[model samples]
Target: MNQEDQELQTEKKGNKVLVVGASGLIGISAIEAFLDAGWIVVGASRRKPILLSGRTLEHIKVDLLNKEDVFKTFQKYKDITHVVYAALYEKPNDLVAGWSDEEQIKINDQMLRNVIEPLIAVGAPLKHVSILQGTKAYGVHLHPINIPARESDPRDNHPNFYFDQQDYISEAGIKHGFHWTVLRPQLVTGKIAGALNILPAIGVYAAIRKEKGESFSFPGGPSFVWELADADLVGQVLLWSATSPNAADEIFNVTNGDVFEWRSVWPALAKTLDVQTGVDHSFSMAAYIEENKDVWAKVVEKYGLLNHDLNAFIGQGHAHADFAFAYGAPQGPVAFVSTIKLRQAGFFKVIDTRDALTEALQSFIDRKLLPPSIA
Candidate 1:
């Protein structure tokens, strides 16, 4: 066999990576992406994930917040060749005030440090570290951020765990030989149960609202343009970031390389769900979903869905709702970031937001999580 074939065969038989935050939306998608590419993946999280496929994933329950738990976990995985740190800690209150919360910094910083310190302390065979970040790094939460936010733009003068975590990794690099890369993706859509993922969130939202005979309404205030990144695509980019030499010590903004206004996207979601969309309606999903938890339970039971807890399904993911349904003050908020750095770094993969959103919504239906939209 040729050299490329030999490498493929070798990976099929032996490549391994330990993905932290394995139960999360990004972590779960990253797991599938890596496994599809022939990697033997070990998934670490606070609780074991209910995986649709584990052909190559070894799930381990780990608490990154607890130092000893973090230490003991890595001690058992000395064979990990690459580390994808997708883990994050956001307290319940920080959801609304993360831009100014102090705990957001402390906890998230420690979580990142906990993972790398343990493995590095044991001198594991780690080669590259890939960290999953989001547009929050651009300070979009505080307000409507700069249009087409570039990688070289100045910090948003806000308090964020992304900075704390990034600084931790950078500091470690000064003393360690393992190179690292950072991937900042906009709203990532994917299927991960019990986690606050956008696609499933949308599926459940539409399914519940449609059944109630309420015409689909855009929840956020004024219309504003935004971006999206598919979970699977982000996973592939994470892998590329780890292996690509140009990615080291660099932060790349990732998206589907597309943009849309919520008003325009609303109709598409309505058509996909087979619901009749109506005028824009500004309301807090946090309040709406909470008040309608019993309504969601009926839909889940009626549809034989994976989750019965509306809070777990929607309440916990309020942050994602806040982002998606955002119609913040001083005019509607628009979060636009440039992916030129990622492209310039040699990774060409992209996902069109419309198709990405539809694909994820369809996946929700295929899995019986949502009843097919009315004809």
Candidate 2:
């Protein structure tokens, strides 16, 4: 074990945790992580999960969007020692460009005021409340000054709902007397029992292209860079934030230490799948969609897919092709907190990026969640 892992092994452990989004990707793994550390976990989700396996775990049905449900849920579990808010109204695919700022703000603000504040107000024995914020909190469309974004960096000039939500949590924690920490994770990829993720989406796309004997090309420019963090790493960071004194009241950027361009990742994934990878004739979203729309339509029809509206299904507008292509290209390194900071403070656990990705992919396959083509 490295210094970070050693330090993590020594930190004080909390007794019970309330995971708000226990059914989501990050929440699922985080619940398990807390349980592994001997913390009693109470998971709240709109639907009871069929795949979660744990004897120490309890499940509660609560609608976070409903203030009454939020309050009732907290009242039921006021003795919980920690809280991890992984639930959000949006999904990763919601890339609609035409969404107005006011619409976004109203929805996010209500969630915080209705759900977050009540939990803090109850002021049970809560020692820590960890909120899972994401890179968009910094601004969804703004470019970062530094590749890896740090917690202290100035947020983008454009206001976003995530920023407002973070502000509410911070202020509430201060007034309600609980230690609060915000975890800002970028492009989280991991294995989930009954959910989809970016990695799986990419893998399924590649598998379909291969079955059709189509060449795969880098979707966008080669200059775009993204820092990918495994879900396990983010889960560990969440656990550490809730229990480690060093993380109290601080915001940390959780990301894979290494940065890679799509040019590298696309080819690497293609090779792993033993398929031909080539650039598309046109990388523009408009052109690609226009060209492949028929193909995708046929696939959806053949499979009898329930959610088949590509634009709405993917949460991108007609401009999705453009955003998809643009996000694919390497932009720059996203700045983030060095594990050294946490390690030096006596929390030392680091995840190997390659191992993390491989394990995540294998998990998809093991769970039979891989698309038929890939299987």
Q: Which one wins on lDDT?
A: 1
Q: Estimate TM-scores for all models.
A: 0.92, 0.79
TM-score of 1: 0.92
Per the 3 Å backbone cut-off, how many clashing residue pairs does candidate 2 have? 23
Count of backbone collisions within predicted model 1: 0
**Candidate 1 residue pairs in clash (backbone atoms < 3 Å):** none
Off by over 4 Å in 1: 1-15, 53-56, 328-330
Model 1 residue 190 CA deviation in Å: 1.6
Q: Candidates' lDDT values, in order?
A: 0.76, 0.63
lDDT of 2 by residue, 254-347 (tens): 7776766566666556655556788554355444454565666665656554435554332222243345346444553343444445455555
Identify the candidate with maximal TM-score: 1
Tens digit per residue, CA lDDT, model 1, 255-344 = 887787777777777787778887777776666666776787888788677766665655356556755766454455577888888888
The superposed Cα distance between candidate 1 and the true structure at residue 134, in angstroms, equals 2.1
